[model samples]
Target chain A: MPVAIGLEGSANKLGVGIILHPPHQTADPPSPHDSAHSDDEAFSTRTQKHTSPPVQILANLRHTYNSPPGTGFLPKDTAAHHRRWVVRLVKQAMKQAKVQLEDIDCICYTKGPGMGAPLGSVAIAARTLSQLWEKPLVGVNHCVGHIEMGRAITGADNPVVLYVSGGNTQVIAYSAQRYRIFGEALDIAVGNCLDRFARVLNIPNDPAPGYNIEQLAKKGKVLLELPYAVKGMDVSFSGILARVEEMARKLETSQTSGGGPWKDDESGQPITKEDLCFTLQETVYAMLVEITERAMAHVGASQVLVVGGVGCNERLQQMMGMMAAERGGSVFATDERFCIDNGIMIAHAGLIAWRMGFRTPLEESTFTQRFRTDEVLINWRD
Target chain B: MAQPPPQQPLRTLPPPFNTSAESFELIAQGAESLLYRTTFLSPAQPAALKVRPQKTWRHPTLDKRLTRQRVLAEARVLVKLSGEGIVAGGGGRKVKDPKKKNDGGGDNGGVGALRGLVPAVLALDWERGWLVTEWIDGVTVKLGIYQRDLAADEGVLRGLLGRIGRVVGLLHLAGVVHGDLTTSNMMLRPTRTPGTNADAMARAEEERGEVEVEGGLEGDIVLIDFGLATQSVSDEDRAVDLYVLERAFGSTHPKEEGQFDEVLKAYGESMGKPGKVVLRRLEDVRMRGRKKSMLG
Candidate 1:
């Protein structure tokens, strides 16, 4: 068995996790969550023969850096927050795992495709730990970590993946040892649009902007028109974000000026903030689902997996389920524990790479901020 | 004793044209529609019937709205282009014909013709969500290129590529942008003689395992599948259109990627000055891969 400790601070969230990969054992009962495809005989047979040992999560913990309402987390502040918490989180995680120092095999950390400061903070912590524990270091791509973790948790074999987050929105499929991106947001990412819109409404970031928007959307019924821009499988959200922000400004001015409730032109009902949230979610999620469906049809894939932070939205999952069900397929998703940025996914993906004889020298363990998902060679898969 | 015949499964189409099932043969299926080959007006004239099935997953109102909008958009673009080409070629417009020698009659020097470059829209019904157009008989540019032998002479392939660029230039000149410009969306119809059907060509290529270089790459490029087309004259939109085709070509035919500049050269020559501006904008689009960098 090989045990790896993964550290991640690619964004406002700082996570620490320890994983144990037990040797392959025959007749090991399939995980209960593996019900995603229990009815598909072909998928079961195709996946069973080459399935790697199911990963064992020893300890996974995360701490988010929450800025005040109307403000986003800055790189400098977020880096300081991660630096302050990384040591404590690692110590707590190791203690929770109850594993001796010698039992650990390697240390893994997110290397790139994130904020420069936060990634650097986590990389430094990982380096110190690796030197102190005298373990090898594995650098992981943050996107690949999310993907591998989603697959391990959901057991979706050969699925077209829709990855949506604050910095990225991509429709991906595995082909020829690479996670090829078929289409993506042509401007701002779907999550970035939601977060900015939340700021416009002065919504608190206690949990997450997207989660707060989802809550507000649930109370909303009026479907105000928002610009829907989708080109082939690719989507654009900057236009929608601009229009919503303007609407928010107008709504605030009317309320602050002591005017009567802003009545909708046709319904005579008061236009509320919830309606804006509702419209934004509906339009953007539809675009995401549409692009994902296009990718599925293009690749002739029946299975789809949703991963990344925004993947935690229940509405997105529901809409994706509806789309997938129409094609005689189903959607697989994990809860916020795995969907949100986490260290376990980094540890899991890194460990798999480690098993394949990949290593990062001390001189080459630097982090970057602009790595693409397709840059990583997925050698672990066929 | 009398014996009864077994019942065959019937695939019913959407209303108004569902009575004749024998004439409709499913040809291709896309994300939003199903395409069928059928006869229109006269039995001998083949036509393509594109039926946009109602998406059950979406709200019924939204589904109907989208289907109607898309069907009308495609029909409008096709109709406009189809008319522009004939006006330039047939009536007193003295635009030099690329394929045939023109007997000069009247001067309409500035007009761009799309004749024989796009399928004519024979009929359409936006409410029922179907559009009928003249059927194009040929293999797609993707298959034509794929079927060509790797060791064959590159001149024919280059000529085909140039024609594709010129045709796209004419489309842009007519103020239309093909949002999705992949090789699979373009058909190579043999001049004067109808070539093999796209499906039959694939089967023949697979069986023969050889490229027939004599006439493999000669045809008039006909653009099809206008579901995502839009009427836009902006250089940015034209550049994006070209960018889409460029990326599609690189990914689909990596072997012939080096020769893609032939497309741009011909496009620039056809459009004169405006095409150069679009090509310049293309450099910017290529740097970002159709997306701009955002704050992390």
Candidate 2:
């Protein structure tokens, strides 16, 4: 039997997975995330109150922006980051699996649904490694990987995947034998809006800016009516972005010396940081819940799986849980490993595909940054 | 279940000069002609035979000229489009007409033999007015399960488009237009590496690259059926050719066609030198196509 290692380097995340099952194997869940870490020494222990089932964190690492902030990391720079981190990450993952290098069978990687520059960089590296090692590689859809990882961790085989990320925010349903994109952002993502608003607010791209913003929204008291817009399955955040800018600019201008509205009180029923945080949290999470409810009604699927960096929001999860319960369906939320970026999902999804005989030839080892989940034919099924 | 073939007493003539063993089994009866499948029991040899009905050509003088030109055109186009004939199936160069002079016109079999197009073998009148050519072994591009079965096989699609773009470039360079460029016309050939067998073991001692590259690749791609094609010097025609290919791409293969950029990218790369003028006009052609679709 051939041991297959999967490599995923579509964007900044460099991932590799190994699958041992054969194409002839009977139907079973691939890489079920129902086990605790094979070894616990490699991680820093952090305990939480909720006892979610221990996920099989089969070796994973995330290397964020080596390049300085301000400007987005160019494609070449991102690829360089991948080339440096991939080998090391894979080695660490193997150590956790306690498997030798060659024991790795096929390598699976993300081909696209990302930037072309980043995609090309990963492509060259993957193609070269596969050629030298003579390993069959499988290119996977990044979005699909997110969805699959969400399912693997949550055990939701057919939940509507709501992917909310820095670049993408969409309410997707599996229909017509493909991922029919039911709703999406008209312009920027909810994350992008938050990041830009944070830029205006001088908020860093910290892991929990959403959580931090939620904190500040608590202080805000004045009923600052902001734009709330949602069209059909699609949602618009430009209005939200514009509304925040207007409030900020208004506050700044009024306090600039002359007899302005702010000059009288310096702060009129001043919107506290908590209120802003609460309002932002309420607004965004409400929008998410609204769209998710709409998607459940649309797909007739009561269960919803929220997967992405944004899925970590407590308010978002709470609302989705409330919505799911109201509809008499379950809401699946991935643990931190599946929520924040990690190689585990790639490994999880890749292993499933490898078991299903989705192998790649050497000539096609290029990375695809923008692979649509709907484009790939599902190889694994319930 | 037991329907008999045509009643024409068109003798059991095998398409000649093909390395195949079995005779040509006559097929499809056209008002003006007929088609045939040339079968060879030998695994190594492959070919096809096409035959037209008798007295289909009313005018001897004009029919002779047109058929002669069409056959010559197909052969000429194949020469330029097919690389030193490396990856292409060796086309049938005009051989001696074996039909009796009193029997009249030669077989009009060479209409689709252009660029080692994959469809037929021995595409010419071996005895009289018959077209025969090499038979290809592959599935239709539409049926290629590589993408579905193998995840990283998107490159195979790109390579196919690259082959298409390169061939289209060749035809355009020679001022030829393949009026139809659809999924059915494309075949996915297996890339054969050195295989070891007793016969292959015996042949291993034989040389490499064998200056004689006759029976090797079938030229990676066999674009079949150029019967509705034409050779011209107009940019309009060249753009139309691409339009046909692009449209066929969208309609025939919807799921896989999402990678249409690969085709255009490859086309942009291969059509580098001669594609300058026509490439510029391609924009206009696309614009006009969009306008026409909207209005119509």
Candidate 3:
């Protein structure tokens, strides 16, 4: 059995995970019904009968940097933060997993769909480690890990995946061939939009005002009717962003223009932060769920998996759950352990590649802040 | 104890961004492709390396003329810019302590000279298509050198200019000209601490005559990114260099208004005969730039 260690540092979080698996363990893998070479032996053999057993929880640890949302997107800090934590996190995870460093099989790290800095750190660490230890290296897709973990937990044969996070928000569907992007946010991710809107509301992310907004939304009524734009499976939030800024201005209590309206300018605004928060929650999550619902209708699939940091949002989960119930489909939302970014997802995706004999040579260790997902042809046979 | 034995090997190394890169390992991705910090694998430390994927080189029918040669040319021009302090004072204060002076500087950091530019042709093996070179350390004046106090004093700046003049003179002497002379090419580094009177020291001294290259302690400057650099005898080529520098100074260090005139003064004091030719055309280029800025 070849051992695989995982490192996920696409964004601010530096997550490390290790998995020891019997080589080529999967007996039943997703069929290559989506690709053109459906009848090929190599393609067929790639699909296996045995899945890596559920008991294969290796070592996993995630460390996050306190970067201000929207602006914490610095490449240098991402690299520096990863450098600070890679060795320590790996050692800690190894200790927790009760495994020695020498016994590791290969190193796997996120390849792309991230800022340049953090991705570079993980790549550098893995390149050095693989060379020193004489182990193979594997680069994993940041998005695939989320979907893989979704399938591992939910057992969704085929489903609509809503990849909603800080940098990406897309309606995704995996055919027998490949993951097809059905619709995507035109500008920023849903969570990013919400975070920016929250900033306008003067919400601090010390404890992550995302949770605060959820709590506050529970106590207030939706007085402001905001724009709810969903086109087919795609959605637009720029109008929502502009309208909210206007509402913040009109309400006068918006506390914009650096300081709030004084006694002379105070008009006793109609909407409070609480009301705005409630309406925001109602609007954004509804847009996401509606888009996912439309994607489901287009794909004719019954299951949905919500991944990324926003997957942990209870409001999003509840709304998704309600939509799933109405459509007679199931929605799989990751727990906090899996949410908020972690290395286990990368490791999970890595385990699949390791089983398929995908390995990096000693001479190759680099990070692409923007590597393509579909470029590396998946050897779909498990 | 701080210095390792000359023979000790490095513990870690830079990685290749792509799997196919052969010579230089991809250290990080740049605006275009993966930046590879190469591994010399010898007793000496390897300079920086970057890998631009071969796939991106595939141009449609429209852009056949723009080639890898263009990339090398751009780097060469940048190297020249660094030498002139148009990028920043070479090996001076800005690079030494970059966290000083943030009162009201309107500059983007990392607008400095090439930290190192020896142009070592390790091997003509760019199979992976990368332009590997030394990574300069000093941040740019755009970063607000005052924010980090990275500005070198007048003595250091003079040392920087005298050295820079000789470099620009060498380029003209070598028959090559830098098309772009923006200060972003400048490398501002900290000077070694002086004995005294450092407080009253300014960056640019009042130049009235020929450069006094005393003590033979000339500063270091490296030009980079020679995309537009071309061998030239025409007055237009050299004038463009001064023009670019003037624009860079006006934009980057806005507080130092008319500072471009001071740089030309220093440049004139340094270049001698050809310097006068460049100076005569500098005014023409300035008027053209002003007209373009207004029209745009």
Candidate 4:
């Protein structure tokens, strides 16, 4: 078995995981160290056959750096937080997996499309481990990590991936070795919009702003009107964010002036924070579902795999389920353990690449802030 | 949440359509609408019926709102483009050739140049999410390109590409954007004498062979499937519209992709000054990869 350890600190979350890929019975073992192009065809053929043993997650642990209510985490502070805890998390993860330093075959880390400073910190940790342990390194695209992990956990083969996170929102489907983007957010991401709205509303960041909003929204009955912008398959959320922020401000002022709560125009019923949360989720999730459905229709795909932080929202999952069912398909999603930013996905995705003779030399082991999902050649899939 | 029991088979003809379902033939079922081939009033006059089906997943109110808005938007654009001289008899304009009145003359007395280039709207029932238009009798550019092997002849391909560009240019010049600009959305409607269907049909078949060689590319380039069309004149919007078509051409007809430049050249000539700016903006859009960076 080849084991790989992954470290992730793309944002406020810092995760460390250990994964093992069991050896195939009939096939020759993959080269222990990086073997260049000779093994490429054979590796791809093996993957295409789907003959590799099921991946085993030996250990997956995370520590989040939460900001105070009404505030968001900054890159500088988040980087410092990751630097302070990366070593401890890694050691703990290794111990929990009952694996020794010699047992690890590779060290993987998130390579980018995230906060610059945090991504840099995690890359440094990965580099240090690789040099110290004399193991090869594998850099993973954060979004691909999510998609691959989602597929592994849900057993969704060749699904249209709806990857939603604070930094990115995209609807992707695989074609000719690339996870081509079908649609995406044209402005701020859906998760970013919700997180920003949560700040304006002074929502707690204990669990997560998005999670808090989802809870509050459940109690909300009024479906307040908000700007809905769906352009072709893409969506724009900045307008909706601006409109909701203004509404929040008005509600705050009304309460401060002792003028009573804001009332609905037609019903004269007082509006509450819950109502705003409900409206935001309803409108945005609806947009997400619509775009996903469009991509599915265009590609003639039946299965959809929702991944990333926003994928954890029950309401989103429910809405997606409804849409998929209408098309006589089904939706696949994972719990926050895998959906939210995590190291296990990085380990799993990186191991797949490593198995296919991929490696990141120590000198070239670095992270980027603008890596695109489609930039990674998905050789593991058909 | 419990999944709604399996979707009921889609209604063949909901409400208003039920009365005339027997006369209509389903031609295509698009993502948002169902297109039926039928006649308008008389059996000789063919028409297309587009119905926006209600989506069960969407809230009834929202579904109704979107259906009504799209139906009206498409109708409005068609009506505006027709009146502007993009379509023959669109503005009720007289043809330049008095002798060819029954032939549906290709020339309209200068509304904005390209005449008979769009389908004329005959009627609309917004409440029922249906609209009827004069049926275009011809093949789609996609099929025409495939069946004729348009790429085999450089001159013929260029002419066809130029016509596509000119028609789209006029559309943008008239302040409308066909949101989805795939080759399949356009039809190559052959010209004909108004009353001689049989003669026109025979001539069209003969012309198809000649079209493969002579490079005359003679026909009206009629745009269809206005389901996603919008009224927008902004240079950015127009550039994106053209970009969409450019991508569609590359994907659908990779062999002929290099000839798309003729389309842009013709588009530039037809659009004049604004076209120059839009073409320049298109470069920027292409360089930026048509989509904004995913990272915040």
Candidate 5:
């Protein structure tokens, strides 16, 4: 077995994980190896049939920096928080995995598409570990990490990926050697929208604001009308966020008046915070599912894989499953351990590349905040 | 994952379609609508019928709202383009007035009016998601480009490309953006003589495959498929629209991709002042790429 450790601090979360890829069983014949330039041909050949070996997760750990209620985490503070906990998490992960210095093959870290400061902080930690352990370094695209980990956990091959997190929302699929983006949020991300709305309602920052909003939404009864801005396969959430924030203000002001509940003008019924949460979830999830379906129809793909923090929401999973079922397909997702930002995905994806003889030199191990999912050449996948 | 079973045949056609179902021949099945080739009022006149089927997955209210909104939006753009002094009339004369044809027969009006750049909307039913328009008799620009030898017919190809640019320019000038712009969405309507017999017109369309390579390119570029179109006057939106076309041309016609500059040049000339600004913005858009960076 080949083992690798990954470090991730793209946003406010700092995670460390160790993973192992067991050698293929000798009973099954090995697949043919081809040159990277023939990736399209390789993909077509594998599309007929391909199976991946099981991956063992030795240890996975994360520490999130949550801001106070009514506020959001700043890049500077989040970066400082990551720098403080990354070392401890890495040490604990190694101890938990019962691994030695010689057992580790390479050190992997998120290279970007996130806050510059946080990404840089994690890169520095990864660089130090690479030198201390005298191992090669592999720079991983954060979004790719989420996707690769999701696939490994769910066993979905060549599924369309809907990656939604606080920083990004994109519909991606493998074509040639890249995970081409088919659609995406034109403005604010879905998770960011939910998190900011939670701020307006002063939701607790304990666990996660998105998770809290999901719980509250389950108790909601009325489905208030919200702007549904889906243009082609792309969507915009800024308008929805602004409108919901205004509604939250009205609810607060009306509640202050003799402690009465805010009532709708037309129906004259009380509207609770739960109603707001419900409306936001229903509207946004619908948009997400619609775009995902469009992409699926475009590529003629039957399987869909949901990744990132928003993928952890049960409501989103259920809605996605329903949409997939209607298409006579299925949806693949993972629990928080793999769906949310975690180092295991980075380690897993990077290990795959490393096995294919890919490595990031010490000098080129720098991180970028503007890396695109399609920019990375996926040498590991056919 | 398994492939979805073949869709079941529709149980019954909606209101206006119920009586005309037998006459309609299914042509294409799109994501949002089913396109059929049929006749309008009489058997001699051919028409294109677009039926936006209701999606079972969506809420009835949302589905109805989207269907109605899109049907109206497409109709509005087509009507505006086909109206007097617009693209159909060449920006000066009334389409309904025969005597005023000479005045409209100039740089902008002459080619557009005579060419029939857009199919005239004959009828529409927004509530039922049905829009019928005069059927265009021509081959798709994709086929035209593929059939024609670029090296031997470079001049004609450039002219056709330029006209396409002009048509798209007129569309953007009218504050409308064809969200999806591809070679496949454009038709090369064969030119017709004033006294040409109906047989000759049909023959020209039928002989497109055999004559295209030898006869050189001939026809007006008519844009179609407005399912994703939007009414927008912003330079950013206009630039994105052109960018989409530019990408389509690159991928679909890589052999003649270098000739695309002619398209942009003609597009800029048709756009004038606003077009110039949009062309400038296109540079920035191209540099950053169409979609925004994935980072927060």
Candidate 6:
């Protein structure tokens, strides 16, 4: 078995995880229709014919930098938070994993497509550890990490992937050894739109802005009119975001002036803040689901695997499940542990690449702020 | 909370069509709509019918809004495009001008020369969510290019690509943007027969030889599926349309990807000045794929 320790601080969250991959086994082709088996069983059986064993998460831990209400985390503060927590988190992860320095095969860290400062902090930490421990360094793509981890956890073989997070929104499918993007958000990401909207409402970002929005949306009964902008397979949310923010400002102004509450046209009832949240969520999620369905039809794939931070929302999952079931397929999702950004995914995905003889030299270990998901060559997959 | 019904959940025709004795031949099933081949008006007139079924998965109100909006949008774009005329070339039968009576007698020379380049809208009921258009007889540009003899000369293929570009330029010139552009959406309609009388002509063409080789890089490029199209004169919209087609063509026809520039070349020449600006904007659009990569 090869053990790898992954350090992830691409954004506000600082995560350190240790993973071990068992030795290769005899090849066993998994049936695509087989979902009766447990996740672990399915994980073990489904591979690209290399018979790669199921991943073992030795340790996974995270510490998020939560900004105050109505404020988003700044890159500088988030980077400082990661810098302060990186060493401690790595030490704790190693101790929790109960592995010695000599037992580690390699060190992994997120390479690109993230906040520059945070990515640099993690890379510096990974580089320092690699030099101290005399282990090779494996650079992993942040998006690819989420995808591989979702596949490992759910065992959804060759399904279309809808990766939604604060930074990214793409509908991807595997083809010709690359995860080709079929559709995506043309402007700001779906999560970013939700987060900014939450800020306008001064929603607490305790667990997450998106999470709070989902909760408030549960009580909202009226679906307010919002601009529906879906062009072909691509969607634009900046327009919708601007419109919602304007509505929020108007609502605030009316309340401060002691004007009558914004009443529902039919019910003649006051529209609460929850109604705005509900409308935003419904409109955006519907756009996401529609594009996802279009991709499914284009590629003729039945199964769908949703990953990233926004994947944790119950309503989004429920909506996706309905769409998948309509196509005679099911949705595969993980809990917050794996759904949100974390280190284990990086470790798991990196180790797979490392085993395939892929390594990032120190000279090429530099990170980028604009690395695309499709740029990564998934040679390990068929 | 509850799951939606599974795929192929007993689809039913909408309204008056459901009561008609005429048989509806299922042509294609897209994500948002089902396409059927059915006769309309007269027994001999063949038409392409697009039905946007109600998605039970969506909220009832949202579903109704989308169905009505899309159906109406498509009908409006088609009607507008059909009104503008392009120079009809090649050996195809002349497009029967619907506005001929409105023009008051004799040919207004080249007026509506490109009338048949897009199928004329026969009828549509937005509330019921279905559209019918005069059927164009022939194969899709996708299959036409796919069936080409690889060993044959590339000249004919390039010519076909140039024509595709020219037609797209004309579409943009008409102040419309085809939201989804792919070889699949462009049809290689046989030009020799009467365009309206598609039923008998299609059969006659098929009997001549393999439909693919019989035309062999010959025919007018007729655009179809206006479900996602919009009325926009912006260069950004036009460039994006070309970009979508470029990406789709690359993925679908990797072998002929290098020749896609022929389409753009023709597009630029056909649309004159505006087309050149759109082509410039296409470079920026290409730099940013579907979305620009930012913070993780």
Number of clashing residue pairs in every model? 0, 59, 77, 1, 1, 4
* Alpha-carbon deviation at B295 in model 2, angstroms: 36
When sorted by lDDT, best at the front, the candidate numbers are 6, 1, 4, 5, 3, 2
For model 6, the superposed segments whose C-alpha errors exceed 4 Å read A25-53, B1-7, B84-114, B144-148, B190-218, B251-258, B288-293
Q: What would you estimate as the lDDT of candidate 1?
A: 0.78
- Candidate 2 Cα lDDT to native: 0.55
| Order by TM-score, highest first | 6, 1, 4, 5, 2, 3
lDDT per residue, candidate 3, B1-296, as tens digits? 00111221222322343343345543322212334444444525565554433322112111122334445444434334234343343322322213223311233222222223323333222233445555444433333223433343545344444444544654554456665444434444334223211111212322433333333222234444343455465676687666555543443444553434555666676568978987898778655432221000
Per-residue lDDT tens digits for candidate 5, residues B1-296, read: 01133253543556777975448776655446667788988888899988877766555666677787778767655665555235433343222224212221333422222225677777888778889988887787877887886467566787778777877887887667887677767888776534322234334435653233344467767788776677677898898788767855664566788999988998998789998999998888666554454543
Candidate number achieving the greatest DockQ relative to the actual structure: 6
Q: Pick the candidate with the highest TM-score.
A: 6
Q: Write the per-residue lDDT of candidate 1 for residues A222-304, one digit (tens) a residue.
A: 77767778776777899999999998888888888888877778688888999889878888998898888776766667789
Give the TM-score (0 to 1) of chain B in model 1: 0.78
Q: Clashes in model 1: which pairs?
A: none
Candidate 5: give the clashing pairs: B90-B109
At residue B244, candidate 6 shows an lDDT of: 77
Candidate 2 regions off by >4 Å? Answer: A1-25, A28-56, A66-72, A208-211, A218-223, A254-268, A272-274, B1-296
Error of 2 at B237 (Å): 39
In model 6, what is the error at residue B69, expressed in angstroms? 1.2
**Can you write out model 6's per-residue Cα lDDT over B177-279, one digit (the tens) per residue?**
8888878788887674455323233344457452443337778788888888876778998998888788767656666879899999989987899888999
Worst lDDT window (10 residues) for model 5 chain B? B95-104
iRMSD for each candidate structure, in the order shown = 9.3, 26.0, 24.8, 6.2, 4.8, 5.5
lDDT per residue (tens digit) for residues B1-296 in model 2? 00123345554453353434565665433222344555544645655554432332122332343345434434344443332232223332333223313211222222232334434333454124455556656655545522334444455455556556655664555455665555545555554223312123124323433221222212244565453455555776676667656754553455666776665655666567657667677778656433221000
- Candidates 4 and 6 compared: the better one by lDDT is 6
Task: Give the interface RMSD of candidate 4.
Answer: 6.2
